[model samples]
Target: MPDVPLTDEPLILDRQPLPDGIGERLAAQLRFIAEADKLKTILRASPLAAADRRENDAEHSWHLALMVILLAEYADEPIDVGHAVRLVVIHDLVEIYAGDSPVFVPGAAADQVEREEAAAERLFGLLPADQAAEIRALWDEFEAGRTPEARFGKAMDRLEPMLLNWLDGGGTWQLPGATESTVRAREAGVVAGSTSLGSFTGQLVDEGLRRGWIRPDEA
Candidate 1:
């Protein structure tokens, strides 16, 4: 047999070296892109507000981050509020591309997965590989609603719109001709995520009726 060289095998590199500050540069690039794409929620047509008065995705993120802080104490299950907050802050980043889907619309959610998945690839891809993967994982977790943090994050997501509708005297609900059953169905998962939040939502619904924000239609 021909003599085989001990070092004949090619050396496989364990990892590729990243360019200096590549992660940070990519993070900065993503930050700027996200800020520029702040059009998502703001583009939503709101009859209650002036034609120009719309909430941007950045504002939505800030609102939910605050909600996570304010409502963490009321969670039915113990959650790392920090993680939940992070999830909320990033959850709708895809809406920067996919646009916000009104929750009351039936079948609208069916297209969300495809739109958001593509958005995720583009948005997250702006970051360096490892950081992109991490953020993408968190985003996916929030979408899946499987983890405790994700459940809490989703609960907050639903709760914010309910509160907004109530405060604005059924703004979107009025436009969408939202019914009690529709509201209930949209929010039932929130209750499943956190019973305390569910109870609070029920109270809000009662308050909405009392305040003339909503009314019961004939059965």
Candidate 2:
């Protein structure tokens, strides 16, 4: 099976006569797209900068992809911008099946990984075999974070929510029990990609504290 182009609406393959093998592949692509639409309903812990509602998985992926493009220059080392963009875009797709896991939440890491891995396999499998392999590989690379692209991709993933939290007056961080240490610990991954970004986020943490949006960690 081959990759098929995605459309905003459900794919309409009836108009044209696809070659025998191609039709099934196209249908498979359509099915995957439909399945992916579920991502729009899975909300994350971060809120939109200007909106009252929380950000959803689909929106988060798009924002992170754009951030990857704009912030590529800040990466610790040179990276493949295109590959990084693909990595970010597909990174959250698994959440469609596994659901969004809030970083500050405790004791969920191991379970989240197991659930997301299962979700990745099931969701990616919906695509045509070749396309599925390509997407699954991209997801895996982003998860591993061994490559520069993956590192930067993960950085954007961590940074975007922090930025949003600050912009929304510490939206998620405003939850009563949240503290500086916990938030910083959760977002520490940003440092691996860019010390500059990490420093910038540290400043945001300070600002969050000053503005009384988050509590300080107990010594």
Candidate 3:
């Protein structure tokens, strides 16, 4: 978003005066919209229930938004569904740049935190300054997971992939180090936002165990 020539041709300050009202705001917003298209290419570890290929970040974010609409009533505390939807969608825009870190794979990305922070800054900074800060704040709220909306958003975040795994013939459950116990520990946070979702996630793991989809880990 530097002040380079807005035209297709090379820089020419003297070339016919710049348009009377070229809107920087619209330009930045359009750039962000175009950049977000890359999320569709950033594939995740979880498989789609109906497809053979892994789910992409854009698909994952859409599913989370739908979950907020359908499942917000199940939250442990009352939540703002609209706000929660925003959190879940904005939560992964960082991954558009930093890329995804698989939750089931231990040590998948050692510097995931650092990478995501930098991604957040660069991606959101594509917007107008005020809008950039606003969107980034939503991302930070989801990461903090303190507010009611954030907690439920976090719950949906963990639950979606687990649900997909269950529906997709074990999905990521077959990854190295994945086990009933470890999955439970990682996904139990779903309960922190919604006891029902927590219980449902437990049921999925139990089913995985019964069907021999995931191994039993004692450690």
Candidate 4:
């Protein structure tokens, strides 16, 4: 019967009280799952493949998970596709707290690491201790982009938006700070994980430029 004040909190569903005496661990895990659902509300600059509107973090993550499953064979090195799927699924849960930072936006990446680090702690801490540590480690591994799975995960992460942009007629590539030169440079690391995908991305980038959908680098 008390006032539930409105706040700037991300669009999260109201938690339903469990039937009395549910164990704290299960409750905590469920609460963390619900909290992470806020990823659905975090919008990114990349347009949907339909190009009708922008996609949210949840959709983006789902797409990346599928991409990992389909494209793991293209990886430059052996990688556990299941592990890579996990990475893609959880990679943007941090965006629930930190919010989506669009790559094409100049200066938006400032303090991104610091913000995401804080968000990871606060968000994943919602889980029970051991589970929290495990998921947090995957999040960190994806961020570090060191291992084969993580590297391939990172490759899909970068490639998805590039594919989206090309599919959407240069989606965010038309935005400021997204010249062909910069995009190619930014996406060049895809090769570290998948030589095939990196080569394909190069072809797409060049085609976008030729079609005049992407901005050419200023001379």
Candidate 5:
């Protein structure tokens, strides 16, 4: 062969010539981001306000984050909106692996915490050590619902689906086995977050009952 050069051979892949540490960290972060994107595909039992299709975990999280910005003033206690937004955005990320659990589904929530805990570990572990720890901590805080931010985050979470269901004429509430008591019980968390939101949801549930869209609990 005439004047064969190393440049003539193509590399197996187009790899960036980044520093080892930087490259490794960037790869890990990218992998986590890719994995997190799956949340957009995981559907929830609740439908969009007026749309025929059901909502996905990613949309729910985004809605809760936006609601936090607009409704923070209604919280029973003052809240840190930035922190609340972060909590809401990451709150349902575990659902990407554990799957969505309907609030009014009988016996469905019994082992939900356990399943989500395992999912949190696996999913958050995809990030670099520090980032993984930070996200896991935020998730834990939201689950605990003790801090003001966490409480407000939860309020937004409960309020979004409730509004959608109300607007959709008792969307999930009309599903078989769903009843007023079961939904009220599950949504008790709303009052813990914001009394004003709690009142609004209570009114919606009452309206759903009067309209005969929601039946009384069999229990």
Candidate 6:
């Protein structure tokens, strides 16, 4: 007898219908995890000492949201404060992947563009199609720093660190060899983003000097 021929049909793995509302539930869970993961990045970026307590991503988002509420009056142009708040919340999510690049680090600043772009792709890819697109757009808008919302969001980013350093006795700036000119140059982004806040930052710098939080070079 000739050798028996085997069937050509492929074997099937287990098959079943998805549970009720499974898609919705799964999406919700993914969103929660994505949001939580972002918190990790923000805390890592924040330089707050362990004794002083660093603000995590979630706290940073909330603080920016509050700033939108409290400082709307200072915006240079009319802004959708609500939209601005949303921008701030998602702006740093990419840091979860790229890690926070401090503004003062020369190489860190130079590499930020490529690192952030890659991070945005991975971080925002976690959401459902529509949500991911929406968030990615918002992140892009903030990076462009063109629209009023983006401008304000960028301004807040600068303002927060300046305030933190000022409050914490030059928290990060107090490190040996940190200089006023360097601090001001790092903060120039605020002026480029929002003139109003940039002016405020100048005042803060002046205050920082008077308070001895920072020192002028050659002093």
Q: Which portions of model 5 miss their true places by more than 4 Å?
A: 1-22
Residue by residue across 83-157, what tens digits does model 3's lDDT show? 999999899888776778887778867888998888887789889999999999999999999799999998988
Clashes of each: 1, 0, 0, 0, 0, 0
Q: Which parts of model 1 are misplaced by more than 4 Å? A: 1-42, 45-52, 210-212, 215-218
Give lDDT tens digits, candidate 1, residues 95-200.
6667667665566567878877887886677676777899899998998888888887888777777877766667666645466667776577678678888888
Off by over 4 Å in 6: 1-21, 24-35, 41-51
lDDT of 6 by residue, 1-219 (tens): 111111221211112233455677475445546444434435533455335665665667777788877887788889999899889988877766566666554565677788778877766776677877898999899888878888888878878877777777777666554679887875786786568778989998988888888778775
lDDT of 4 by residue, 1-219 (tens): 111111246434344555768798998888888777677778888889874988888899999999999888999889989999999899989877777777778888797898789888888988899999999999999999989999999888889989888888878989988887779875787877888899999999889989998888888
- Top TM-score model: 4
Question: Higher TM-score: candidate 2 or 6?
Answer: 2
RMSD in order of candidates: 13.1, 6.1, 6.4, 4.1, 10.1, 11.8
TM per model? 0.76, 0.87, 0.88, 0.92, 0.87, 0.78
Which lDDT tens digits does candidate 2 get at residues 155-178?
888899899988888788976547
lDDT of 2 at 100: 70
Structure candidate 1, residue pairs in collision: 42-55
How does each model score on lDDT?
0.68, 0.81, 0.83, 0.83, 0.81, 0.69
Comparing candidate 2 with candidate 3, which one achieves the higher TM-score?
Answer: 3
Q: State in Å the error of residue 122, model 1.
A: 1.0
